[model samples]
Target: MSQFAENVSKRLCSLDVFRGMTMFLLIAEAAGFHEHFSTVTEGTVFSGIALQLHHHPWNGLRFWDLIQPFFMFIVGVAMPFSLRKRLAAGNQKKVTLHILRRCALLFCFGGLIALCL
Candidate 1:
């Protein structure tokens, strides 16, 4: 493998793990694990954890509310390493432009999907 690729891979292990755990939590939320726990273990410590696992009803924040921000933070943490790796691999200006455009597209698509939801 390329040196740049190797360097990025080595540098990003922790970031990748963080990102994966955030995604897993998001998926668990989607699967209604929190709701299930709340129903099954009401008034118990597990239920308390279940409550924290869900988003606040309104005008407040919960641990679940941090999932998106945590995901974004992970992305932000990796961006510099990724860009440096690409540059070190001798990618051209056009390739950098393409990467920027793709990032914009992803942001737009995410916003659109959120709106639809």
Candidate 2:
């Protein structure tokens, strides 16, 4: 029942279980497990998941395409927590400055990564 405990609880937790689960599902789906299992059964947990795990044959979205969205969602979730912490620690005046700088940096980083492709 203290301010310190409240602050501690408000800390940004980057290791979210949902994020980890999404990453795991993405990696496993991208590993060709779906194709491997598709040859074996028509009905089963692994098979059904594998069947629904893929994009619609060749082009379109599914649970498979949601992996990137999940990552973006986690980033969005972290932002509020991160900003709250920074602002709470008497960094209010610079919060906007820092967020803008970081967003610009992230944009440039994305561009650089895209250029590599």
Candidate 3:
């Protein structure tokens, strides 16, 4: 392997797939796909799958319930790889500044969104 290839670690494709799947499911939920889909698929063979898309009632776990935790897991797994990549490309100070800037922007945007809602 080349020096650069050795320096930069391989990305986890499975994690990317999970992240994409989670985002797609979230977007579908936001667009009201799940409600319509469940209604349309009711009493059919796909009803069970459609129901799995919805959250479980209190005191139970469901596929939808895992989405948030899986998203967090993906982030947790990716962060160290991201930091390592940045550090390999530059120095600790630059990576730390980048992380700080990202956090600040995310917080500001989150607050703005909350205000809008």
Estimate every model's Cα lDDT from 0 to 1. 0.82, 0.75, 0.90
**Residue 31 of model 3, lDDT score:** 96
Question: What are the per-model numbers of colliding residue pairs?
Answer: 0, 0, 0
lDDT tens digits, residues 19-117, model 1? Answer: 889888888879987788789989777876777887877757778888888978987888888778788787689667979899899999999999999
Model 3 CA deviation exceeding 4 Å by range: 1-9, 55-59
Q: Clashes in model 3: which pairs? A: none
Per-residue CA lDDT of model 2 for 1-117, tens digit only, reads 687787675444454778778877777767876677676656766676666676676565566777778888888888777777788886666998887898899999999999999
Per-residue CA lDDT of model 3 for 24-57, tens digit only, reads 9999999999999999999999998898899767
Model 2 regions more than 4 Å off: 1-15, 30-46, 56-61
Q: Which ranges in model 1 have alpha carbons more than 4 Å from their true place?
A: 1-9, 107-117
| Alpha-carbon TM-score of each model against the true structure | 0.75, 0.63, 0.77
Tell me model 3's lDDT, rounded to 2 decimals.
0.90
Which candidate gets the maximum lDDT versus the true structure? 3
- The TM-score, computed over Cα atoms with residue i paired to residue i, of candidate 3 is 0.77
Arranged by TM-score with the best first, the candidates are 3, 1, 2
